[model samples]
Target: PGHQGTSLKVTDSPRKRGYYVNSPTYGGFDIMTATVGGVWDSFLGEGRRFWITATSDSHRNVEDGGEDLWPGQYAKTYVWAAPDQADIMDGLRHGRIFVTTGDLISELDMDIAGANVGDTAQVKAGQVVTLKVRLRDPAGPNANSDQPELKRVDVIMGDITGKADVKADSNPTTRVIKRFTAADWTRDGEVITFTYSFKAERDGYIRLRGTSTDELEPQADALGENPWPDLWFYSNPIFIRAR
Candidate 1:
């Protein structure tokens, strides 16, 4: 009920509005939808690399006359940390996490210089930074009984202008900086690795998102269409401080 669009309003002043679209929740379960990344990039531009996680808040099962998927059955948040509870908490607090829908990907790793997600890298402005990304799709079928294929990956960047410059809506300055095709990457047994190099012009953040669907652009969902066929995965951002 709270997730309904009519009951929601996008706002930067969360203290006043008491609510904001945490991430775009449109077209049902289209996890690769650009709307979510757009919203996240906006916050990044405001110097807040807001953390995001995926969960199935399944209060009741559809078989029991409810409309929700079981927890970890549809979406899951993976945190890279030790087995200890405290470490897991620390990982989440630091934004070292990734989310997958329909189990599209089993592993996703990214690094810049020597910093990984949730870590900040300091470098001189105009210096080129190399980003390395490794991803692995599940070799077997997911819950939906379909083996997903990695189609493409996108790198999104947002310039951090500080909280004082934050806007109340979408940040026009943030955008997808690069897109990579799976065919160009090194692959072996469902795993693929790729690298990107870019010159730092200013302080910013970068994140990754990939999809199994071949649609280059997000498609509008028809009424009552199923969203389980499309799978997507998103990674937390890595901050960059260039002086």
Candidate 2:
């Protein structure tokens, strides 16, 4: 029961055993697609939550080798069903997922219960926590990918200590700010969100980052690369407890 070869030798045998012995090496050939999203966020620990599916381990449409990977090219986890031939594999095993390489997002939702972002659900004092995004437009835009550019939607709330300089035209679509709080919004979509209301004494945790078109530079670029083309979406951080 040990035959997981190729992908260039399971991504080149752990950097060839850390250069035979030198040590200090990184990159695990995309680390099995990032451990399939960190084994589903490490089994949704802590407060317990789970919902993510976008598999294509199709094995070349159930055939032979199929030139190794090619059936939807990667990505499809749009759960929350109502039209299917089998509930799309039971809504991807019950997790109503979403992930696209070509883009076809029909619906995306996020509620912060008692929101906070420039004062919406009270809790003032530099308050700010309102990230709502909805997208729908992708019936046809393919040619190997690259036609989904709906950038700038980052509303981060924790873990960077401090950062401010959002002036991509002095507020284009929407991005309100006012920090010094701590966690309470786990995560959202349309591209990135993580808030939990930080400030029981300021520990950390809260996120939101959805801006693409390769980010047009000057916004935490840092050698930006890949689909990170400005980071279209990422929200998964809502942990705070300082009592």
Candidate 3:
């Protein structure tokens, strides 16, 4: 870890606080969001690269009775990297990973339910099938949205050889009753809807990811009190019973 002479952006200080950092403290209706978005791709005049980690650069140590910042206040982005620390760093530097504060979303996939129609069978023709998921965010205080509204749902489906991103309509028809998003902590009790409808031709499956996108930093919203804006995201993809 003492390779300071390397080209990595070894900043001992914290990055500027953005949307996700400020909104929670004010009880905003919208939950703050943040994503790796993408890596720098390349830095420095040469082809050198470095890893981008979502970590709590908490400078205030709890040495005194006063705590500087909460433990794990920031996200810990783990790349699907090798045990070698250098490989881990390389994986992050090349945009090969993403960080989350709440859930661990390692993989997502979808498929059709049945080849033929039957009452007890999971899949059927002339019916809409779906996939869904929910991951855990270890560094988060859960979803802190103003009204707990999910805005986007992605149905990543098809076989291992073929895949596609199907954005579904947020409605009750495509949801798992009393599960997943339904039990999600949307305290406002608003009638948030989620749905994924598509006519099936053969047997297959789908993966769903429910997302709530809000300003990462409210103080920066174009029409809000903030001068800078940031983006927030939350999603958990799951395999659904499609018949």
Candidate that scores best on lDDT: 1
How does each model score on TM-score? 0.83, 0.24, 0.31
**Ranked by lDDT, top first:** 1, 2, 3
Q: Please give the CA lDDT of all the candidate structures.
A: 0.70, 0.32, 0.30
1-243, model 2: which lDDT tens digit per residue?
001111212232322311213322111112211221233223332222334333333333212532123444423345556787698666555444444433433344443433311111223334443434344434455433555554444344332122233321121211223321114223333333333332333323333333334332223211111221222333333333222
Root-mean-square deviation of each candidate, in angstroms? 7.2, 17.1, 13.6
Query: Ranking by TM-score, best first?
Result: 1, 3, 2
- The TM-score of candidate 2 is 0.24
**Residue 176 of candidate 3: its Cα lDDT?**
23
* Model 1 agreement with the true structure over 56-119: per-residue lDDT tens digits: 6556554554445567766778999999999999999999998887778888889998899888
Q: What is the lDDT of residue 51 in candidate 3?
A: 28
Q: Which numbered prediction scores highest in TM-score against the true structure?
A: 1
Cα distance off (Å), candidate 3, residue 173: 30
Q: What root-mean-square deviation over C-alphas does model 3 reach?
A: 13.6
Residues 1-243, model 3: lDDT tens digits: 011111112245322232244432211112212111111211111122222344443444333322222333223354555899998776554534444332222222222343111111255555765422223322323322222234333443331112221332121122222223444433223233333456654433232334444422223222122211122222212222334
